[model samples]
Target: MTAETHAVRRGSARSHTVPTATGGGKRRDIQGLRALAVGLVVVFHLLPSLVPGGYIGVDVFFVISGFLITAHLVRELESTGRVRITEFWARRVRRLLPASLLVLAVCVVLTFTVMPAITRPQNFTEIAFASGYVLNWNLAASAVDYLNATNPESLVQHYWSLSVEEQFYLVWPILLTVAVFIAARSRMRAPSTRPLSASVTTRRGVLAALLLVFILSLAFSIYETARSQPSAYFITTTRAWEFALGGLVALVPGLRLSEALRAALSWIALGAIVACAFLFGPGTAFPGSIALIPVIATAILILVGDSRAAFSPQRLAHVAPVQSVGDLSYSIYLWHWPLIVVVAANVSAWPSWVRIPLILVVTYVLAVVTERFVERPFRKPRGAFRRRSVTFGTMAASIGVIVTVTVLATVGIQNAVDQRQDDLQEQLSGGGSSSSECIGAQAVYNDCADPFAYTDLVDPAFAQEDGPWAWFDSELAATACSSATVGSWVERSCAFDGASDDDPQVLLIGDSHADHIASPLQRIAEDRGWALRVETRQACNPFRVAAESDDENAARCASWGADVIAQTVADPDIDVVIVSTRGDSGVWEANAATAFRDLEAAGKSVVVVSDTPNVDGRQVSNGDLITGPACVLAAGSVDDACSWDDERRDTWVEDTAAAEGVPVLDLRSLVCPDGVCHAIVGGLIAFSDENHLSGSYALSLAGWFDRELTPIIDGASARG
Candidate 1:
């Protein structure tokens, strides 16, 4: 949402003064710009393909915020000789917090009633972060976390941009005050016969400081985006440059052009913005050099005077429809995302044609109501909220209530989860129970015996505990040995050292799919007295191929795979190599075959593990990845909602294994049986998310895995 500012009336003549913090008429053109920016963001979220680069709307808002806020700060300093920090902050609180808090409260209520129980804790935590104005950092952390990386879009994910703006609001005023102070001190130190204009000197000082910050921050943004793209996208350090650019524009003295020239530049700048939105997509490395396109365009649009020339961009921007959207931009931004998420999660069966318009219309109506009732009321003068103490107190109370409720709800959910886990453990401990027959593949497509005859298809006690999500706490995730992204490779070697150093050295390599099997492999290595080394990356395969659309990640994956191959071939101690990956992509076959050939040529035996069954029909509701177990827990006997066709298992991996004369260890029976895959087998949750096997389930396969794997390794070693 654009920062709240008083609307400026359109200039009637060319000589009219531009809008400023101290004294100037409103600029309807800027409001139209706000409308345009929010429109892009809304459309992008609704139909991403239609406006691929619509996310740049956030950059537009950032620039607008920087310009307007900086102008106000400079004007206050010029008019009053000192900045009122408390008053400045109070004004910001009054303008932004009421609607934000109202929306947050509504989202929290929905989280309890409509959101999946599996994601309530995370949603609550995000709510707390959003309320505290630190959602950006929270999101930045999640961006780098492998487990959280693919999390469904959060209702409050959009709050990250608001967090960034709020942070800017907090710090920018303080920085300006410091600059003004420094300028005053420098003027006092100078022995001058003639007095200098303090306002001009202060403005110059602030501008110079802002320019330096802009350059440094922009450089950092570029460097960070290259080094860590995910982190760069959300962190404040990488985004400060956008705001600094706006501040620079605000600080410029008497920036004016002829009406014709201004109109021409505005149109070109607007076109550049629309072009960036259409051309860019998720693959684009953002807020780096590429981000310069939109940032610069937004700045130019703001810089061009609001001239009402015929066919002028300003005149078009000032249209009533556009202005209305702009007027409600803040509330629209706050309301739209959560509504989109909620609707998508709950009403996904509704066609996109039906869903998109409904989402927009509902969002607009809510925005109007919130803008009128919530935002405007708090901001009005001579109201109860006008008093700084009342405003601050109300804000504090609102935040306190949100945090308190979130914490209580999280605790209650955790308790329920704990109790459910205890029940599962009890069931497992009771060895010869009737439930054992229905465990694993036997339970699939078997109406002969009821697995939950004694209990429930999904246990009633643990049904609301988010059983599938609880599986994330498994050993594999806790260790974090696998690569999170393309370039993040960490070598993890587990050597039993039970006998001599000459013990059979085994190497496990692949993507996160390989990492999921690491716990069981490590257990086997310790028990069997073997040296096991794991080298895996998220989404990376051991074979050299373009597995991902991101060129950098694909190249890195290829390079990493090549290095692993070279090392495996060179080491005489390496007796066996095991390759595992999510075989969802057929492109992986060629690479797997190549790795197999090279390893066999070096006299090292190879075994390829079959890819596991993903929860085929699962839906990611409201940013939470709903798994089979989660679905079953939510609605008992979901009629194969969580199962997939076992026949569709990745054939390329199997084919490569067959061609290379290596044993292909098909774990399909363990995960999916009788042509159907189930979400929960026995009492254990199967998959963590959609594809990756839960650590608990994988570890539970230790017995079956060991029994099946020993003979193959033994035969291979005897031949060697």
Candidate 2:
């Protein structure tokens, strides 16, 4: 999911209830919770291996936000008989936007100056989305996208939680308003003799609505997490339950316990929160059942009421240091992530002990400065900044400026990318004059005609200017010809290689790896007058024993694979079944062997393509995952600087093909020459990310592909 940067509630009084401009007191215990939540997140970011579940801190913030915001709204409704939506929104703007926009502006400047050109476009887009409080939807879409899923995290990735909170702020007041109206109408319709007042009726109605929302959202969260974990994590609907749980605590009455009982519950809640932060991890199916640990714990702590007992957890929370950190929590959350990302990007190997302290000191300094100069000034009611219109106008202008600058920067970067693509294309076309002599399996590995070569430059451009790497999606991904989401299967077929109703049918099957090669294969199919049907899924291997976890995806992939095999066997016109995947290890080889054997028994010829070498050197910088090629390019180093020298001896495909007596195609020689896998080969960026091939690189292999495939297809046709 996403991280949220929550502002500390500003007030002078000391009480458990949320503070309002009118009168409610401060909750030092709540501030301590804020300190604890941010502390977990900061530590998690600094040393994730040490605190694997620190991400749960974000959920804690969500619960705190829901409880506090709901309490404030309910208080307003009780006092005024109606919620002031605009005034509430104005206060939120004053409290949150100034600090948030400052961070965005600084991040944008850093993106253009220090971040890689290839990553700027995406970051800029995210900046725009974050500014508009819709980053969650953008992240949700990217999360489910098979190609985008592998992308390194964004600098603004943490903004999704803030976006979620803002969305709640926008809608919750409107819902309360409606509830108030219903309550008022009900009270009016009741006899004048009725005992219940309008406020009581309204409160009951609001409580009922909140309860319904909490139930529905919690159920959706459970279902969606099981079905599509990635989407579930970022989507507002799945996360609304956590917020609603907090709201229920605020709206529901008679929840306060005796001081002794409260203290006990408080300690239990604190233990639960701490235990979750230590125990939960990435592999944990989050915000589902596991998320209840942190969410419920946070809710319980809020409901227990802050106690002054010597042994009370609230007393510990009320300590000066914790309250101080809580005071700086918002600005610290805003500053820390980008700083970490920038530092990591530049010096990824920095030890955590050193990095953590450095990040903390710098983030604290910046946060203190921002909070004093930016946050407090606008928030105080003693100056010109106190004007509601001034605060609202300033917030609006700051957002507009961020959007404008991000757009201009993105457009400029895209233009540069387009120009570089054109130049690369020209060089590639001219270099291909010797294609006849150099375009084959043997010539591909040596100093043959390098279409992507740049003679004048000292280093190859590691980042693909225009290819799969440039945009994570390839031709197949763009066309939606394969399954890109989890637990969902959509069999998409398209005619390729000028194949018509009478042409021989060729079926391509497997996962995303199969889809990556579809471009070159499409050209081959068109040249040979064959119809190519591509059947693939995000992580589905199409193996007899599915390699994926035994979840919904595994079941769907198993069923999908069986249906595809049956159709291939049943269709007499289907001449060959081509299988390829990213790797050959695990259960894939076994599954591939079974599929090949089944096709052979059905009198269908099978072609098994060996998996490509995966170069693993990408590092997380400033939140984004910078690829080896991009890193090398940014450093102005030769391709060897990022090249992988070790041999990938996984010949599972060849071994399985031998066992099954099927034809095999190995593209290793073409992609990795002289037993070395380079991030950039010839003049083109070799890989889309670490594992998948760039569309341009894959397309460049068309000549060699046709050379090897023609014999297999011809022999199959001859046999037929």
Candidate 3:
């Protein structure tokens, strides 16, 4: 649906100087570069797990943007003898803002229509922050989060990069202006007959300085990419170098290289980019050595492709489809992501087959409308109003929308679907709490007033400041804080006393989630009268162990998990090795299978506990049911909300345990009943927030483990 809006006036005077497109190439080369970068990003986003290296497309875009923007700025400075900052910004606003604001507006509307009231408030706040151009900061504060789920305002997470570039333009122009002022002043004061080479030398010097900064920043970015991929991926500081590198490339006056070198370089650059694309899928090292390929490839196209080149890529880039995409690239980039995210969030299912075409069609339509209407009018010659006032009015309109959205989000948050929490007041008011009597009672301790039995269930407080069951245990709040504070570790202070040299053995090793399970392990060890030995770290899943990023802590955790397993197996005195940890690539699951194999070969009894369910790693309990009536309405169904899915139960938890040749305990079924999962079982809350079981609930589950583990222990001796 396309809407036509009226013209608005700019603040004051508008710079009338129009930009002169420089450096003739068959427009194809530029278009091809744009196509390649955009296609890579789209594919990567559709299936990041499949294309780990595809994210390099953003870097590619940065380089292209840097080159184009710098080239334009340099040309203007040289021709006009002055760069008009206002006009530059006006052009930027016309080109970028209209489409962006439209996307934000759509996201806000979709969020209201589709997202659950419980989560909608947070999403709205995120969207407002994103609109205000502080999304990077907002996301950085959250850190390492992949905003792919049903977030209220997450439709536009990808816009953070655009925000970074916008921010760059905001500051870069002033710096360029300073450089221009200096150069012009120097030229005027110097002898008029000075050789033209002097101008070339001055440009070269400035370009050289920019190049040094770019190189140095790139080095830092590479280091950080390995150390903290998430930070390196998102933060602007680490990324500025790519843009600067492109700007540096633009500064070179004459690229008169031999055709052989050009072709060789082009082929090499193309090979680098293609290689990175195929081999460097998602989760691969990035902004590191891997990034150089695409960045350099983009540079090759800009530098080597010219009118004389026999097989210039410019023709390819300039094709109708490519140019169309390139023309609306800004708008396509802005609108496509949010549309895809919102559709995914609302639909609750995503597959490449469906999503790929959907994103393309939606992006094309949005981009075309935004370009034809919102953008062209403000920039083109118009008699109704001055461009500067229109720009000002647009800015004011955006801020006004921002204010309105912010207020609505606040009100929505304040009035987030309220439940009859009074029922909760009565349950806690009574003696202790009622035991959960649901069908899955064995798997769920909530039937026995076990607070942690439903740790995976959503709670009411989720919509409130404190969340559901805030009264049951303040530790729910404390635990989250504690989890964050533990930091990433190579080793941790044991939660329980260590087993003596002569005592029957207890082996503990796993990831951060496993560490969280330490509370339960300590109780089990005490009840069984065994020494507890634990080896675990934050984010170090024992299943797939690999040292990928530059985070020192991840490295330490990887080494520790392997060493701990080897040492436990070597000890003949150790009777039982309990290898429990969160599984999967996220927590270094690569090493888990080997760790289990070694234990089995050593003839040590290994018990691998399955991982609990979590949303974005945050523990969610059924407590969300208390504040809203959605669960109440869907109370009788065997659908997802009422029943645990196979992914959480069989795949992540059960599959890992079974693969390692250990007894797999499916706890989810025990916690949910009648196809309904409740965060609070019986009258007691199960999970503190999402996954971590409350201390009391964990203690209560000890007997269930005793029933299961006792049989395993009894059978081990007889079999041996």
Candidate 4:
């Protein structure tokens, strides 16, 4: 969790809530708010589309927590005359930390048993960072990131919000302390008979300040949500004022009103709050202008609802089952998200409909267990706080030990895996060039390999492609492409220089995979002196066309593919067009074939590279399971265990490529043999995942490519 800047929202919330002087206990209102927020959050998680704006529940919870905590602190100051910071913090740590640490411990154990070896290190990092309340910043940084797509480690990406809340609590009390001290100093200087326990001076000043903060924060939240929703949603900065809003309400004194007036206000506030919830769905622009309605409405309800007669909603919230769940809401919230993510990862065919009941049952079970075993014991203000503190400190120390042991264990496991791989490499040595060397260049291997040992593609000596390669930021591209001497984004050109305009050649086309082979293909282009030019776009397939459909992105993809083909074929100077793509069905087949036929009539040969077979199984990446690559390599011609296929993809290569009369360059014989193949070729693993060989592996196949490719180029050119 990133540290958030504090302001007026941190003020004591007495003035904003029901007065302490009025003995009408409003536990029912608090219970109702809790129930409403918890239900919304659970429903949102289970079926976000049902209540699209259900995420506002978090904001509501923030307000309630801020109000209650500030109200409690103010009352304590009034009674004791001196605030105990350590005791307050100790209470917070006791209340929140133990269960959190236990969750991490359980996650670590589960991860070791179920998770792949490749992602363990990342999981460890996430666990450590999350344990320390910094997961929000980590997640925000990852949302638009370029690297680590294949082996993203954290199974619990949802903990980012928890981190934000934890960090907020850290500084909030200190500021509250300052407010209390200032109030005390001013009261001591005054000639008053009664002690200024709940003085109007501090309350009014704090409320005014909080009002300013609330307005400014609302603006920031709106701007941030508009520009970067994920960051704004997860970060502490945009969320703090909601909590502060609740605190502001708690600090302000309640208005004296008749029973009828109070009852009327209560109903209005409750109706407004519920109306906001029911009317808005998940699609609502949130943590922005829309949030104010719910926050302010909640504040009003809390202030007014205690005096009113029992409403159905308030009655429901006060029910035993609902109140029990409300008490366990924090634990339920913590457990549910990670459970959803992990379950989804394991079973892609998750029924969204059935998931709600499953979530309710599971969240309830976990929440109950945590409350009984973890939360209840720590909440007692006896020796309980000290004992819980020691227990958490021990758990924290244990985590450090576990991380150390896991790292060492991982090192051992990797070394052993590498050794086995090395032995196999020697046996297959003369057959093919080391794929690891080429695949290493493209940093996409991190997701499938141990990043600690992974090789990068951009040559240190090469000026053009050596810098930082983050996709979100272009500055990273400049850094990635730069070398020892001159670091620049443009005009740093290096090429084979062998391929000239006069030479008859093939044009390779597609997305990043196509882009990846530019260097290796350039090597081939240089050797053969062929005019092989690359025309590629990131994530775009070369043979698709715009569909006359509502899915505009698909339509756009189809259009892009047609344009690429049309542009390539129009250049009569080129002899052939080489086409390759990853996993996608040939939705573009009819349009692709039409464009190709036009090209063939115009006298250009079109060669298609069939999609490579991916690894088949539930394994996330070959890197995660230390033995996954070895298992693939040693599977011994088993068709079921070796080959991967997507039903849609089969239509393109197996059927459409045949129908199109395009000569297919069958690399299946090179990669797969006797119905099975190793992820490793020769001494190095060719692929980081089930498909797409590492840059090194791809480059090593150049000689084999040249052998078959040169003949095709020569034969096609001779005919022309």
Top-scoring candidate (lDDT):
1
List runs of model 1 lying over 4 Å from the truth. 1-22, 183-196, 352-354, 381-390, 425-434, 441-507, 522-533, 545-576, 583-605, 613-615, 618-636, 644-654, 672-685, 713-720
Better of 1 and 4 by TM-score: 1
Query: Candidate 4 lDDT, tens digit per residue, 665-691?
Result: 665544554454444333344454434
lDDT of each candidate versus the true structure = 0.74, 0.71, 0.58, 0.58
**Candidate 2 backbone clash number:** 6
TM-score of each: 0.84, 0.88, 0.66, 0.62
The candidate 4 region of ten consecutive residues with least summed lDDT is 485-494
Query: What is the clash tally of candidate 4?
Result: 44
Compared with the true structure, what per-residue lDDT tens digits does model 2 show for residues 63-142?
87887777777778878888889888887888888899989989898887877555676788999999998999998888
After superposing candidate 4 on the true structure, give the runs of residues whose Cα lies further than 4 Å from its correct spot.
Answer: 1-26, 76-83, 115-122, 146-155, 178-198, 257-284, 341-359, 381-720
lDDT per residue, candidate 1, 469-573, as tens digits? 244335644553333334433333333342467667788888778877876677677778777777777666667665455456667877877888898899888
**Which candidate has the top score in TM-score?**
2
Q: Which RMSD values do the candidates have, in order? A: 4.7, 4.9, 10.2, 10.6
* Candidate 2 Cα deviation (angstroms), residue 529: 4.0
> What is the lDDT for 41 in model 3?
79
TM-score (C-alpha) between model 4 and the true structure: 0.62
